[model samples]
Target: RPRPITPPCDLRLQSQEVQVNLGSGDGARRSMMGDSSTLLSYYHEDAKTMYEVFQRGLHITGERDGPFLGSRLPNQPYKWLSYREVSLQLAEHLGSGLLSQGCQPSPDQFIGVFAQNRPEWIISELACYTYSMVVVPLYDTLGPDAIRYIINTAEISTVICDKAQKAAVLLENVQRGDTPGLKMIILMDAFDTQLLEEAQKCSVHIRALRDPPGPDDLSIVCFTSGTTGNPKGVMLTHGNVVADFAGFLKVTDKVIFPNQDDVLISFLPLAHMFERLIEAVVICHGGRIGFFQGDIRLLPDDMKALRPTIFPVVPRLLNRMYDKVRA
Candidate 1:
């Protein structure tokens, strides 16, 4: 005799068991979402793509002027960047600004994002998605040679960079005639006039301003050094990332993240999948995210100031923190 499967409200979704036969029978295509197959199909869902992730929040909150999240430097109070559910948001404006500058929308068109974790980085990424363009993140680990290789390989015409020192690195490549396709470098923070002057000499346009809401979708391309060859790119479409978010929530939502008034200190490199995945989950749950002060030495100060409700760290950092405390 069969009885009821109780606990109606406390369901904890578990990952499907791994199977040996991937392409046989009702195989790998079989999923918890009975009808869904490719993760990229996440695009066809309610949000459509990452471009809509923030705007969806705006609709839910129904707020017009308040900021979507927070980010700031040391000694300064946290700052907010208003993200109304507008045809009126900064992301759209950035996309339009690029369009006005003749950077047209195309699935193949790529933009390089070289910045630390900040509210601006997310906004710039959303802007890329809105414009039907892709993001190729250039991180510190990639260095100059690889940065040049990626720019030429991706044919990136514009970049959104964080600091003048970083912009100077990209400009060095430009001066060497390595990243010829590169045309503009948008600054996320204030810089000395020297950067602008240097930019002019390299035939690059540099500007520091608020930018965005464009609609549509794009993808991401990350690079890794090949074992025996040069750097190689691995592209993840909109579906790839959002699907990760959906899967994470189903498994952890009820147990670990039941509370919605969540806050996170975002110190991880957004260029990596793990941190971005953390962000996706947080955003889905209406969580607040704050960045660390750029200096690792000031991380404790940033944490104290941000007073986060959530902290995500790797084993390496955990061990370092433990050792520091013990010492």
Candidate 2:
């Protein structure tokens, strides 16, 4: 007989893998759960057409209220803004500057997002849509080679990343000829006089991006984990992600109701599709997104401050949470 399964266990969970259900088919065929499906009905109509699920959703207000995740931390307090406020700001930013001058954004133009998790990531993505430029997100855990591959593959020119991740970009590969298209690298963590000086020295331009990226344009590029050979870059166009977005909304709606000011704590790597989709949902709903002070080790303390309403995680991470709760 096989050994009996024990009730008390000491199984340790790794943090690399995240688990989520991806729906079948492309943009037109995909069925998303949660708020995604409801949002998709209006955005994605054709059954066979590949389309981007942009624009979080038509703005709506709910009666319930609470402290959103990013409302206040440290010296801050909980303040809420409706979905309309956030998405409109995204639209306004996209319409500014060189972005609005063209029918289709130049291929030489590219935007990179290198943050951990926060409103900046979503805002940056939305701005890319307005300008019709492609948004490339970097994995925090990726080595310099992987990072270089993404940059080179996409021919990325402008980049927006966290201050903590700047060193990686400045390392041997990036410093060498590995990255050719990289021009601007903006640090999201820049807060004080030092950040301003860094910006001046690096000649980094810090401002909101404008113009809603066309629905048919490629919105984001996600690279798969190179489990076999070189990692395959999964090109998720706006439609591809939007389909998943709708499917996610369909499933999510049956379980919980979301509001624009709802608090969300994001712990997954933003490069992953699930996290990116979740970020999109958060943007559509108009909620506050809180960046953790550090890694998973510091999330508990951060959680106390953020008090997230919706939390997404891989099975391993969830198992760890269960273990901690039991302890």
Candidate 3:
């Protein structure tokens, strides 16, 4: 069950000086203007890598006890995977499973993730980071032409999709030779022997990467929505994402306190930076994240079941919810 929300402390900006130590033993200090009006002003020394942030959370949460990711079935109660369970699955199952099958991604290679907000998506992202592969997130709402353009632009040979339907679209492109470089389509839901056989005939291997990615290496290539024209790819490194997490903590620590017991409901697409950054923050703070069922109609029921402590929402969703309440 989620804890009741507590009133947030008043947040205001003032002026002072404070020392920031970067976890180094040396008394090296960097002075920065502090907020004199609010006692909640705090900053986390920047982490060198996204992996370090994850490691910090695992250490803090002790891995085995609490829920890290939660989801639901058609009529069953929410299912949970603990931090330890998730980590072991990533390291032993998914990572090695891909590698053994010859799915090795080159350093900083672009791999596509076409899926909804599920635990598999999170595992896949982490697996890519572990192998130093750059992830290209594909929005589920994107049309076929747009998807083809991004895949070609990124030169993605292998993609991980949540369902056979999504994979079928990519598979069709592969067969037509439109996406010549595309070699494999990994479906998260169920194994399709026919697809595997077809991929094999096309000489594409279904696999994972051999080497782990470093902090400074490229982590994601996020494509902007092609509202006016074709989407543009934004390259982000592990350091860049870690910096964002640090910045978020520095600013919101006072008003938003997160801990092991915190529960966050995720409905926004993970392809968007806002949701992705919030996911990283929740993981860093040792909180649980629950994904809403893909249908918007089920959001209300899902929310009631999950009982999320923190709701990170966009203005559109907020406006709709407000209208519903007023009615």
Candidate 4:
């Protein structure tokens, strides 16, 4: 049974009256230990309540617990966020209030997350999930033309970009105006406060004005690389994410809990599904997350500070590492 709501008023006076004999044939009985009894009773009443809370609209990444854990940085100096912070902030940003205030929501909320792999990328993706927004993740290494096509094809309205991809976003904006959906662009660094303020004023509303998405709604539209030409958006539903996460838990059940303190060095592009999935896992676990200060070029320095437990990589990065080792 779920627990009942307890108000502050009744907390102080709460007491237990049960007393039992330990050597009795039925079983060992016990007496209530003042605060212990009240605590047990409160928790007992809350069991069902907690379960229902979880069943309501819990997210694997955004919720308080799943996979993402507390800070894994060896000599924990500062506090880091868990999946809850990532999801809630994302929810607030992508909520109806914000989306309706001219900023678009999912399906049509063409927001591009362009950067190399990092916790922010995953948080941005989760934020998209909260509002059922379209997520267009651009490869960090793509040329200007490819970048232009992706933003144009998606008709991106807003772009959540890193310092490296800021130039590409602007270049695409300058290339054309036929993109009716493309309206505002924001930056994550907070360096360009002036630009951020200006972008916010554009009022390019794209949220499904009338009907907002539910928890089970389509959360993101990821684009896959095309052999022939432009990439195609792969529509992923909230259900799909839940299913995938469940599978992941099954396989990594053993290491999931004990290694919850593992730190992950994210070096892959946020655009890649593998990195995205791992980020999702990290969010689900309420783990401590840190961003790489510089690009992959400064990997040695970043690792010295991070010393991540889980280091995800692509074939290209692996090959480079292998080459370096040989050298």
Index of the highest-lDDT prediction: 3
TM-score of 1: 0.80
Model 1 root mean square deviation, Cα atoms: 6.3
Give candidate 2 regions above 4 Å deviation. Answer: 1-58, 61-91, 94-108, 164-168, 171-175, 191-211
RMSD of model 3, in Å? 7.5
Lowest lDDT 10-residue stretch of candidate 2: 46-55
Instruction: Sort every candidate by TM-score, greatest first.
Output: 3, 1, 2, 4
For TM-score, the strongest prediction is 3
Name the candidate, 3 or 4, with the larger lDDT value: 3
- The C-alpha TM-scores of every prediction are 0.80, 0.68, 0.82, 0.61
Q: List the lowest-lDDT window of 10 residues for candidate 1.
A: 209-218
lDDT of each: 0.72, 0.56, 0.74, 0.52
lDDT of 4 by residue, 241-273 (tens): 444544444444543431346567666655666
- Candidate 3 local lDDT, 166-197, one digit each (tens): 77678778778888888777777775677667
Of 1 and 3, the candidate ahead on lDDT is 3
Question: Which one wins by lDDT: 1 or 2?
Answer: 1
Candidates in descending lDDT order: 3, 1, 2, 4
